[model samples]
Target: MTEIIKAESLSFDTLLEETSFTVESGSTSIVVTGKEEVDACLVRLLLGFIRPASGRLFMFDTDISTFTDRELSAVRQRIGLIYASGGLVSNLKVWENVVLPLAYSNKFSREQIEQMGLAVLNRLGYSGKLMALPGHIPLFQKRLAGLARTMLMDPDLVIYESPLTGLNYNERNQFLRIAREFHLEKPGRTSLFLSSTPEIVPLLEDARVITFTQRQSS
Candidate 1:
């Protein structure tokens, strides 16, 4: 498998200094922070939302920091992100939501996009909501919709931001099972990067944990 994403000595400073350990492709790694807050800077840094102060970030061997918007869009087209809040377009129906990425890339035929969306939704037990607007569905189902959207494109990498958040134990377990199944089915084709609170560590031992410690003032 190719090295899809890599980061070296990623760091940021606002009120405090925050650093992330280097990460490479085909490897499952987690970032845990001592602070209660999620480090949006680190997350954005890795996702190419922002540039690092002085470090290298590569996607498919291309330096992401130097990529033009069009170039970055091409790279992002190959990556799927399941945001912390289930980044669904509230007005869009489930099917529409699933096809959003394909629409952006202009790579899928109408038939192909529909088939892909339905296949993922069916696998996630969400077939009934194909025409339902996102706001109408329950929170868990909305999250499932987000996952479906991410999975529909079958991208090389999927970055999930707190996928199990706001779920009860049973829901979390169900999501994990589905995620594991998805990973196994794809084998080496798709890699996953998950971010969550430290509390989830025990549940996800299969992942490499990188705890983020806040740097103190000199």
Candidate 2:
């Protein structure tokens, strides 16, 4: 099995340290009860946005710390991020947000992109919100649209940062279902949930778990 992420003694500021772990391909992992700064720093480190303060961070056997911005950009395309804020362009409609990355790469024509966007939204249990402007849609649908965008690319690894942060009980269950279905439907697509809520951890069945409390020394 492929190793998607491996970190050893990772530290960033006072938020993280001695955080050693490995995530294999097609597996789900969670880091529970993480501080906000810890979550942000971990994502930054994984995405190669910032260098780690100490220790190593590797993505698919490549030491991300050694990569230049250009080198890292290649790897970034294979990693998908579901952001806490949904991260959709406010000016774009829901469908537009879903297809923006595809459009940028010229991987599909305008008509093809539209169909692909609609198809992904449908698969994620959404319909009829595609034409709605981002500001016009509810926050839940906006987040779903963001998820559709990420899924359209069929990325190798998907990272969910506080995925259940603002959701109510039912909404949280729905989101978890979608995430589980997405993971199970594909082969070799890994997932990492970085959340501060310990309650959300056990919900992801069979997931390897690590906690910020375990990484920090008293």
Candidate 3:
């Protein structure tokens, strides 16, 4: 498969000291040369949430630093993300949350969006919770809802931040199963970027586990 993202000699300074890393597609390799305070920024850049202070970042063959907000939005339309908190609207119903991005973009008809949401919800084992509000659902269900929301758009990449947090062992296993299914179903159609603390290493062994493993393996 062609590389979808590549970063070389990237450097940035957050609240603390300078940090640096180099990343490429196909493998979730990362190198952190500074304190832990800058980890969040590194995660953000990998997801295209923000630009690096210096160095080259390419998305699909184009340099991301060259894109304006409008251009970045266009780029983001092809990507999906599940924030650490799921990023669901508390006031929106489950169905609405699943289709919210498409609604915002006006990319799909109402019927099309509804169908897509239903299909993704079913795939993620969330078919019954479509009418519940985000606060009403259990954490596992919320995570599934978040996964549905991320996948509903059929994005080329899906970035998940601490997705399995606050879940029980069974729930964590279920989430991983769903993620594995999603990846297999897509088969390189979408790249999955997940961020979590070091404690989750064993759980994420099947994945190209980026965080500390990069250092160990290197």
Candidate 4:
């Protein structure tokens, strides 16, 4: 099996325990860490947002710790991150936030990205106003908006952080369905969900579950 993500003895500032696991390509994995800190820290580490205190992290067979800034950016562009809080820039409109990353990359013209942003959001069943600021929208819309941004990137690996936390059954099911179908769209697509809820295990079909509890400090 091709390994998409591998962590060897990875730990960070006592927030997370020494953890090592491999997520193979085209597989789904759920990492349920009861502690919010540990869950967030682990996601950040995997996304290369923060450095691990010790050990190593490898993404797509490249050691992220050893990568230069330019190399790391290239790697990250291939990964999508869906935050629990929608991860929008508060000051920007929903449309702007949705297209922010793509706009920054400068891969497409402004008009092209603007069209793609709204198109994906609508395709994902988001009917909210694109002109509205993030704080003005409901949680479900916020979640969808963030997901729409991810879809624009067409990432090979998608990392979800507490995707079902505050949503109702219908909303949760819709989100899960969209995410699941997205992962299945490509044979080599991989997904990793970091959540604190044990109930999520059943929601993720065929996912390899890994339960993590933070260690007590001495």
RMSD of each: 2.9, 2.0, 4.6, 1.9
TM-score for each candidate, following the candidate numbering: 0.82, 0.90, 0.75, 0.92
Candidate 1 least-lDDT 10 residues: 15-24
TM-score head-to-head 1 vs 2, winner? 2
- Candidate 2 per-residue C-alpha lDDT over 35-96 given as tens digits, one digit per residue, 9 for 90 to 100: 65577678888998788788998998889877888889989999888887687898887788
Once fitted onto the true fold, the runs of candidate 4 whose alpha carbons sit more than 4 angstroms away are 105-111, 213-218
What are the clash counts of all predictions, listed in order?
Answer: 1, 0, 0, 0
lDDT of 1 by residue, 1-218 (tens): 36666656555555125353544455555666544235445457656787767667777788887898898877777777776667889788877887797777788898887888777778888645678887777777887888888777676666767766688888777776777666656655444545546766776668777766566668
Candidates sorted by lDDT, descending order?
4, 2, 1, 3
Give the best candidate by TM-score: 4
TM-score of 2: 0.90
* Clashing pairs for predicted structure model 4, backbone only: none
Every candidate's lDDT: 0.68, 0.82, 0.64, 0.87
lDDT of 3 at 125: 67
Runs in model 2 lying further than 4 Å from the true structure: 127-136, 214-218
